[model samples]
Target: MEAEFKDAEIFKRMMDATGNLMSDVSIDFNEEGFAIKAMDPANIAMVLFEAKNSIFSSFNIEKPIKISVSLDDLNGILKLVKKDDKLKISDSKNKLVLDIRGKTKQHFTIPLIDENYTAQKIPQLKFTAEVTVLSSLVKDSVKAAALVDDSIYFTVDMPRLIISSKSEEKEFSQDLSINDNKEIFDMKSESTTRSKYSIEYLTKFLYSADSEKPIKLSFSNNYPLKLDYEINSDAKMSFILANRLE
Candidate 1:
């Protein structure tokens, strides 16, 4: 099978995001697109990523295939790809050939791993509150929490959407208008809803939020949080992070 991509940056961003969570990954490539669902080693967070055929400028598939690859190895090969390079991927019996073409063509072959792990099942969750906030705001809040501790708490106090973190030395809180759905967020929470999560996972998750589009977060009291953002046309990413309970 062969697949060509005009935009490697999107794939790069996605691979980077997935690599932060797991060293190896299974990418199921169908005629429509590629789908991935994986849980971190600690099982505290799950990632679901999909990119449709329409998202690619050019797509040619001989057949549907499940390709398992080492993210570390893929990253090494991707480091050599230039900004305007067009990427082509061809599959052999046990190797995936990656070629980047621009001024000159660079070819790198990666050995595909055997598909041995079972796929993860995404669960249906009912959340009491959901909010869409600016990606920058989320980054700022996470950074603030990083300064204090490794964990942060998110709470919905009606109009105020709050994020707080405390350490041995200091505590930080950021409050944004939940009513301003256009900018801050659109939220629904009657009670003082709260959930705590690890800042480490959050920081890696937010690393993929390079766009200005608002990030959607949904959760309930002490329940797992679901976060989602659009990567581009026909491509989107969603994450479920288990809440930290004391």
Candidate 2:
């Protein structure tokens, strides 16, 4: 498959979402769009990447393809790309070729071999409430929870959302109002459902919050928390983080 992006920087930003979570990733390119899915090392979390059409700034896919490679290696390869460089990826003789062209032209080769990687199956989640909040605020709440405990509690009400964490040492809580046009949009809470989640996993999951858009959250009592961020018309990325209830 042959694909090109106007600038390599955009591609770099997209790949950063994976971080060091998965050693192998499956990239699916089809007439619909480009999609990727991988589970974190511990299988407690998942990262999904997708981009469609011009929504990628510049994108073109000649044919459909699927390839698996180490996420860390792919990230290292993208680091070599410079600004304003056009990126071209192609599969040749079981190897992936990465070409970058702009003020400087560079080409790198990554050997591809079959690996025993099973794609993660996303489960159907029946969430009690769905809340839309500012990505920055969510990130800040997770940061605060980090200082108090490993697990953070999320509780939602109709007009307000609360995030709190407490330990033998101290407690931290942040309240956000839905009346103001701050970040929260519509919140529906039932029976005051609350769950605790690992702060470390939650922090890594918010790495893509720089988009300035609201992050959609869905949770149920004692179930996994779903965090979704839409990139554009083409695709939406989501994470399923398991909860650690107290």
Candidate 3:
């Protein structure tokens, strides 16, 4: 298997996002693209990541392969990538080879993990509400809620999506509506729905998000929250956080 990316930025960002929850991942490379589905140790959250072969500058794979690798080691090597640096990846026996090319050339090899990982199945959740809004709005709401409470509430009331949190006397709330806020691109709900989620998880999930792009959120009352972040047309990430019981 051999693949070359024009830049390592997206790969680095992906590792950064998933590393918050998992120490390692088993990535599946096929003729179509690459995919990974992993759940955090606590089992409170799951991350689904996919990148199409089209996203790579060059991609070649004779047969399907699943390689498990330590995120720490991979992230360490990716950190060395300078701006606009190209990354070449290949596998040799039990080792994964990474080549960085920019002002200078560098090569690093890390052993592939020998452990086996069962692919996580994504939950088929029926959400009553769905909203699409600028990532910056979600980031700001999470940040504000973090300052006051450990858990945040997402309430869908008609055309408005309300994010709020409360800790004793301290509280934070941000109201976003498709009719009033340009940041809220769309909102739909069959009925009023509200769900609470961990602020810590939400914060980490949005940490690497592109604030300029819109994020899709889906949830039902007391149901898990699914947040979808699109890096591009070919690269996308989806995070699911179990609702915190009141």
Candidate 4:
């Protein structure tokens, strides 16, 4: 089996984001496309990544396969990728081969892990509130919260959404409303809902998002936070973060 991605940058970004939470990952490659599902070491967060065959420039596979790899090793090579570099992936004996094409052709092989891959079951969550806002706003909110505490609170009161953090001596807040904040495209809430989540996981999730694009947030009072980002028409990433209960 062999596959060629349309944009090496996109592939690199995807791996970089996932690596923030997980060091080892199993990638499932099939006729349709490829998918990756992983949970953070502490099990506080989970990430789901999927890319359709359409997202790849060329994909040739006779059968479905799952290859486990070390993100550190893979990312080490990807970090050297130039702007115009192209990437093709294939499998060799107990190893994953990376063929990078650019000014010169290069091949790098990394050992594949020998282990059984178990699929993680995504929690079925029902959210009372949903909001679509510019990704940059969410990223900034997380950054601000990091200065005060390790966790942040997300509150929704009708048309308004508030991101805040508090500690013994520090407090920070950023407010947005559908009617007033131009960056907030839409917001809906059944009632006043609030939840707290770890800022570290939030930052990792936002790393995969395009700051200029929009991201959807779903949550309920003291429930898990569901953040959805669309990389393109054929690719998507979703994150579920368990609430940091007080």
- Among these predictions, the greatest TM-score belongs to 3
The sequence of per-residue lDDT tens digits that candidate 1 reaches over residues 1-246 is: 677875888888888899999999899899988988888888889999999887677777878888999999998887777898898887888998999898999888989997766889899999987878888888988988899999999998888898999878999998777555456757777687899999998888988886587899899999999999887877788889999884
lDDT of 2 by residue, 1-246 (tens): 667765566567667777745566677877666777777879799777777755444445567788766667788989977766678887787888888787887888887758565766777789987898888888888888889988898987667788999999899998877887467867887767777898888887788556477898899887889998875545577888888857
- C-alpha lDDT of residue 128 in model 4: 94
Cα error, candidate 3, residue 18 (Å) = 1.0
In candidate 2, the residue pairs with backbone N, CA or C atoms under 3 Å apart (3 or more residues apart, or in different chains) clash, namely: none
For each candidate, what is the lDDT? 0.86, 0.77, 0.91, 0.90
Compared with the true structure, model 3 gives a TM-score of: 0.97
Q: Candidate 1 has which clashing residue pairs, if any?
A: none
RMSD of 1: 1.8
User: 2 or 3: which has the higher lDDT?
Assistant: 3
Write model 3 residue lDDT over 140-160, tens digit each, in one string: 888889899999999999988
| Whole-model lDDT, model 1 | 0.86
lDDT of 2: 0.77
Candidate 4 least-lDDT 10 residues = 114-123
Assess the local accuracy of residue 177 in candidate 4 as a C-alpha lDDT between 0 and 100. 82
Consecutive 10-residue window with the lowest summed lDDT within model 3: 114-123
Worst 10 residues of 2 by lDDT: 53-62
TM-score of each: 0.93, 0.90, 0.97, 0.96
